[model samples]
Target: MVLLHQLDFSYMFVAIILKQMTPEKVITITRFSVALSFCWPLPMTSSRNQIFGYKVAQMFSIVNVNLLLLPCFYAIYLRSDDIEIVAKCISQSICQIQSIAQTVTCFCKHDTLQRIVDELWTCIREAERYEKEIFRIYIARCGRFYGAYVAVAYTMTILYLWGPLFLPIMHVVYAEYPFDVNRTSMTAVVRAHQIIVSHQCCAHLCVCVFGAFLIWFTAARFECLGVEIQRCTDIRMLAVCIEKQLRLRRYAQDVISCFRFMILFVIMTCSLVMTLCAILIITKTSLLVEFMFLLVAFFFLLYLYMYAWPADHMKDMSLSVSRSVYELKWYDETVRMQKDLLNVLVCQSPLKLSINFLVPELSLRYYCTYVSNALSMCTALRAILDKTVA
Candidate 1:
């Protein structure tokens, strides 16, 4: 009971966040996100459908991470003079955009996405059967922490946009590039443009948030599976729970494995994101704004570990289930009971929940490797960019 309450209280903040980050809610948000990104992060159009269309948005998400996409976008953002400096900045942004779009691909297929989310919900429901309060605590805590992390990161990003509105100094957000608004003196028109930008930014952030939530949900599922183990009674009925646990485990794996593309995308673009951050920070003009950007980059790494840590824990728990077999009163049980015990003991092998167990166990060691690799790549890319600048 004490453990129950501790788990319950620990997830207090998480509960608040989960209420808002449901799968249904995410789908609705994705619609706005799709609309905004294609229309250049603008919500509604000056005339509508001028730039935003079904083909345009669909084509962009599908091909945004293509090899040539980054270079093409960099070219578009280019100016006549200071090509070298602008080129570096554009390269960094390209890395960030491409990395993000890779995750977006996971949501492109509604049917696949629906199945994945259903599996997630099913795991949660199954876990609830054993310990309702404990599951609630873990899910809520996971939800809350991720929710808070995104909120802080988005606030910093938005402030970077809205800072000049409040500050005494009237520096344009990107004065160096100097984009001028070609608008008539219409207040409603200007407000509409602002709304578009706001929606576009929100959608971009939502993609990242959704990715984070997916990992958090997996962790919560593992918590449920682990908790069930401790509460597991060695009885004739134990066989039934074992079947349910296996089914739940498979479902969790299916959900995670479905997003293999997202993971691969992150891996491919991670080096660039790290490189971009490192280069910018070293040559950052504004300390405060760049720091916030750094925080945003850091959260990507945080999200990676959130997925890995629970997977590692789940691996330990699954293996530990077999150890329980050693302590059972197998001698006193009848033939059927002993047989069932034997079956479970054999089934509960050391399970490493990863992408087919090919990836390293999602633990601190793995996370350190991820960080180090990204940093190393960043070093190389920064060196190349530095020589280009010189």
Candidate 2:
């Protein structure tokens, strides 16, 4: 009961702070995110993401973000045959890989990200006109939801790291380090290092989720802008609407470019993540608390799909805006007005959020396809890994 109460209090407190993330705070977080990514150097030799040879490779030293916890990982797992320890090491390695991928991706898409941020700030400035405004309310709600999700993920991760320190709080033996049992400098050093990397990873995850929220707000903002466009009476006002719409479209392009890799990741991995969690949930395990925490992690991971939703919404709304312009009384306008109206061409195709034209558009339909593919893969894996009872 005390644990639950403490969790609730922590959630509320964190959420309160998170909701206050204005555009400036978001940029600060983005910079913090970029900084964390640089902690681990990218391999310049990797042909996939690198420009040349592995020249950008980070040193295998403590200061490097990705390698910062190598000592702690080894110290904790050196002598342990525990499943939790092995799982932790594997998970952390995956995180390091993702951090590396993101760092490289960020480097490649730095300019696009800046433009997206500028466009996002422009929307936020308009949205924050007053709390009672619809856009204000929508974004605030999104911020709260984003905060709650991030809080849950961070709490689970923290508990995974520090649970062994306290008795009852750690219902199961999750991580048993092989370091000297005594409170030595090494122990303190390892613990502090774990805390730092954990927070940095959490920041990375937060940036990912916040990006989705930004997409959601962008969709809603475009919808509002579309509504304004439809309500325009004079040619001048209509022209203004057309310009804003075009700008929003350009912003959409920048966003798509900025998060192309994220889109790819969500499309490819969301189903696999859930499938793994489902398998774990079905399989017997002694670490009930740990498994429950895993569920929290899975829940957060699934939200990666949220990024696609708003984009699809924006695409639909953009299509609607284009169509709605046709419904306007353009017949009554003068020849110059008609020429201007004719000059503003509607996009025949919907706005597509995609990865450089691969994997099709980012939409629920494609998401379902990825999920179905994952389910099939999971089924095959289970068949291969688990023998028949007969």
Candidate 3:
């Protein structure tokens, strides 16, 4: 009973701390991400001194991910004969791969990202009062989602980081080292290293948050464009709307180009992780490990969902620009205005979020298909596992 009380107290304390730390007043997602830049060496700044520091931090982050990968690979090799251990190690490896992919992509696309940030900030500044309100609403919505995501992610990290303290035989990561982790000194060293890498992983995951918010921000602009088009009272207003639409299309394309590769890698890896976890859940004997895999599988699905939801919405909103124009009282307008409206409709199509020739359009529909395929794969694996076991 006393132990239970202590656990409850710990939970309450963490909840309090997290609430206090949450960025409740952040009016712009870009601003919030700039704060993350200080921690993770993201290309959110142009200052020479800061760029030097960011390069150093970026190098350290890459080295840290590599170090984590070494032990994970070695552990997989040492435990190759054990299917369960191998499965666990592979899952960890996938996570590091995700971190490394995002890290390297960010590093390579530094100048491009800076331009995107600059353009996004300019959009924010040029927003009208109503448009600014739209942005604020979406920013708050995203902030709440991000706060919950971080809370859950960090809570899980803390549990795994300190798992060895509670479970005598469990280590933070299921990897083997040349030096015995059973030794107090070695254990401390390994735990410290794991703890640092785990936080670095958290930082990498924030890249997802940034991407998600950008999608939302773009969608919000499309919505604003829809409003502006619907309120067009003259051909002059319509011309301005047409020009804005062109600029927005180019901006959305830039946003998609910047992150498409990372998205592709995430989708592929997350799909594999989900399939493996599903199969492992059915075959694993340890209830704790099975539950862990179940959580992991669910998180991976959510990870895909985070992108799919915004991508789908943004596409819809962008395509709706034509509809918004159609709904305008254009029948009473001059012939020239009518011809221009037709031109707009002819040029407008859904701003698709996809990797050309790599995957289908990323949307809610795509997410459902991905989930369905994963389930199918899991079922086939289950049948094979059953046959092999029998």
Candidate 4:
């Protein structure tokens, strides 16, 4: 009865929190992101206690990731001869490491992140009805995509955690701990920890969604700027438009700068994981395991494409800002206004998001190239394996 009351209280507490978080009928991506990032150290709190709490959560998150990661490393060392098991452990470890990297990046750069969010919110508040409507449309679309991603990720986590119960496995995750998991108490504790860590891992993956949403936000702003340019009828309006265009350009660069390393890391890790998944699919005989690998590969590709598509759209929308200047009636304006417009055109270059200035611009073309390269690598790996077997 005591345990039942505690459970009821927990449920009620969760309900109250959710109620407070979503007072509005419609929940925007920003609000949903806030909820998803409850454990993340986003610079949202003002009180010292809240800041300390976030730090504590951040510490716990890092510890959880390492706890899972160390066990996977140990499992890899223990089962070096089993290719299938090693592949699974490596895949899981890579994900946890990625989570850790993302957490560290967010924690280190929360100030810049907060500034970007403030800029976005300022634009939203200052925007006209049409501009707000434009943002709303993009926000709605992103909210749906983010919602779907969280659903799929959490569903996979649930399946992964519960699979051992209905299968031949002894533990939830394929990890080796120093202690004996054969013992009931130890096993239960380890399994619960694994489940909690897996959920945390899923939450960390929402960083990808947050990044994509920022890109979409930039694109929508560019589209709004285009509209603003079209309405320019005088030097003052044109000046305002030009100022906004420059601001948007700076904003886009800031977004790229903040996420550049993350993009590079993701591309590198996803490429390797895709290749690993391909190898596993070829070597693993179990249909279930093969399907899981296939899903992982597909989702990674999809995540990459998510960034690529928006980045490409943002580039096009950015260029269209300068083009919108052409639609303005500059012929009737004075020579000085015409000269200023010409200068604006000359300065308007295409904005592209690259990975730390190393990779090419992120676009559908880049995404396609990555997919093709991943496939080629998979083919090469398969050939080598076949040759060895022969």
Candidate 5:
């Protein structure tokens, strides 16, 4: 029994160690994959093509203002506490309202309860108004970062679609030292280098062609609301402003939907491409399967963040905003819905504070404590499974 206990404990320790190691390995591999993805050039070679590509890239960059970069960079650079503040605000509002509701529910007399509920409703309305006003400012600030983000997205998409075609040529020209076939003779090496350089030049030409197409497509399809906002001056323009705002919102929603679909397609395509590449590499060389798996894992992680997570978040936010907008039936109704939605959008304010601070933490703590109490549940299940198997 003592020996069996020791073996069980050892196995458990190993499992814990492995689990911790897995997250660290995943982080490392993901970093490398992101670097490689960003570094790889598309096929665009000729001077004319390069100029065209630059022009195309510049079009996207024009609207991709410093505003978009700021929030995203801040999010990346900010401490965990800052992120936690945003998350806490989101979850806490619901809890605080529920708590208020519970307190209001305690009154048994109908007349008194009605009076209390009225006061509570007034308080809720006032709080929501303040929250919305504050959130608008925050979102306006966040919009600055949106432009930079779009530029990055545009560049990444261009690279992903056309990068594979240039990989073989890139491999030939920039082959790592000790792997160069013509390394023994300087003349041979120079000739091989020239050929590889010419291939890269040709690849860049293709990049320019596709890049120009994307830029023109995006510029023609998506107009910047910021540009319109700058041009508005007349009072009668308010009607025009309203129409423009609605149009912009609809365009944003459509773009988000399209992006989500594009990401899904890319992830599926990349998965297949990576699988094929791995198979070819394994067949051609004696590289370890474990290393190949790690490489694939890295690519998947990059895809998960750059494609999957962003698409999912955008879809969720778009749906939420659309629903809130749809709920507006009258001027008063619109104001109220706007207030609630704004509270949800803003990373700060009490409405958000009450939900995050009072709800998820409580639930999470309860879950953790309960799981600890039932620590042997897994073991018991394992025993049952073993018996069933026997």
Candidate 6:
């Protein structure tokens, strides 16, 4: 019965770890799918016809933007939830293990009990480090996402307020024709259409400008995170050199991955904005021209969502690998310390056991196991990052 209970507990632990890992993979895949779906052609037949094409295209653009972009936002929300869940699970696990170590201490020798205490303390510290890193990455990513939404909202507002003002202006601009010698006047319909199109062109320009600002802002923020991560890694390496157990390598890597993903999103967004700008500069006053620009903008917005979806996954993987690396390094240090202490104890040296207990056989073995796991996670994350770039 005791053996069965032990097995069951082990299974539960494994299950939790698996659950935490699964969400990272799922989030990455979903986000990528959302990004690719933006490139698909619109289904409206009227959008392609010269007479009614502009209105049809405009309607379809609205639909695509709402459908594609909204879901990407939803995906980010889900990923954030997953990160919080994993963090809580890790914290709880550490507490439980610590409690178990305390309970088992009464039956163990003084040296053995002390070693176990030290190891448990190390695990708690590593877990805390992991939690901190994950939280930081989450906040940064959220900031970029919020900034994007703000840009879109501002663009829509500009369009709504300015659209009506253009109707009269269009009538004035298109009313005078030099080549029509037989007729002395222009129709009210042509004038009104011209006014509306002119207003739309201005609106498109404003949206493009807003989008450019947002993308640039996001890119800059991501770059800052990259720099911070690099600093952290340097500090972590220094700690390692001093024989201190600190797990921060994975954190650094995650920062890099986040930056890469954000850059891709910004570049794509910038390209879309440039295309819209070019369309606006054309002197042609036809409705077809107006519709084409709106369609392109709508598709680009969908593409942005799709591009951003996988970002959470990449961030998660980076965090996991960093945590794993830190834990492994901590374990290795604990083992080394334990072995030195054991040596002192066996030699009947008059040295204090607490100070000498840094290295131990059990700790060394555990460190090896942890290191192996960390390496595996790192390798996996690296592969994912490569694929993302490709």
TM-score of each: 0.63, 0.72, 0.85, 0.85, 0.28, 0.22
Clashing pairs in 2: 39-65, 44-53, 44-54, 45-53, 45-54
Model 4 lDDT, residue 294, Cα: 74
Candidate number with the higher TM-score (2 or 6): 2
Model 2 lDDT tens row, 43-70:
2233455632222542221245554445
Runs in model 5 deviating more than 4 A are 1-242, 249-265, 273-287, 322-390
**RMSD value for candidate 1:** 9.2
Residues 1-390, candidate 6: write the lDDT tens digits. Answer: 533454455455434433344223322322232221221122222233542443344444344333323333443445444532332222222222222222222222223323332332343344344444444454344434433333343344344435456543221221223234243343444434443433333333232222222222233333333333333333344334223212222222322322232333333443544344343334333454445444544544443443343333333332332333333333334555545433422432111101123222112233345335544554565566567657
lDDT of 4 by residue, 169-237 (tens): 665678998977788898778888888777777776667777777888899899988998888878899
Candidate 3, which ten residues in sequence have the lowest lDDT sum? 21-30
Model 1 lDDT per residue over 38-150, tens place? 41222222335632355356465445433234433544466435544454445445444644464356435433455655564555455444455545555455546655544
Quote the positional error of residue 82 for candidate 1 in Å.
Answer: 3.6
* lDDT agreement of model 5 with the native: 0.33
Question: Of the candidates numbered 2 and 5, which has the greater lDDT value?
Answer: 2
C-alpha lDDT of all candidate models, in order? 0.52, 0.59, 0.74, 0.74, 0.33, 0.34
Candidate 5 vs. true structure, TM-score: 0.28
Q: Which stretches of candidate 3 lie over 4 Å from their true place?
A: 1-24, 27-45, 139-143, 163-170, 179-187, 281-284, 385-390
lDDT of 3 by residue, 1-390 (tens): 534554565556544544434222342433444333332233455588877777677767778878888889998899888877876777788777778777777777666667776777677777788897777666555555665565556556666677667767565677777766788888778878888877767656666667777788789899999988999988899899889989888888878887898789877877777666766676665776576677667877787788888999999999889999999888999999889999999988899998889776999998899889888888888888888889
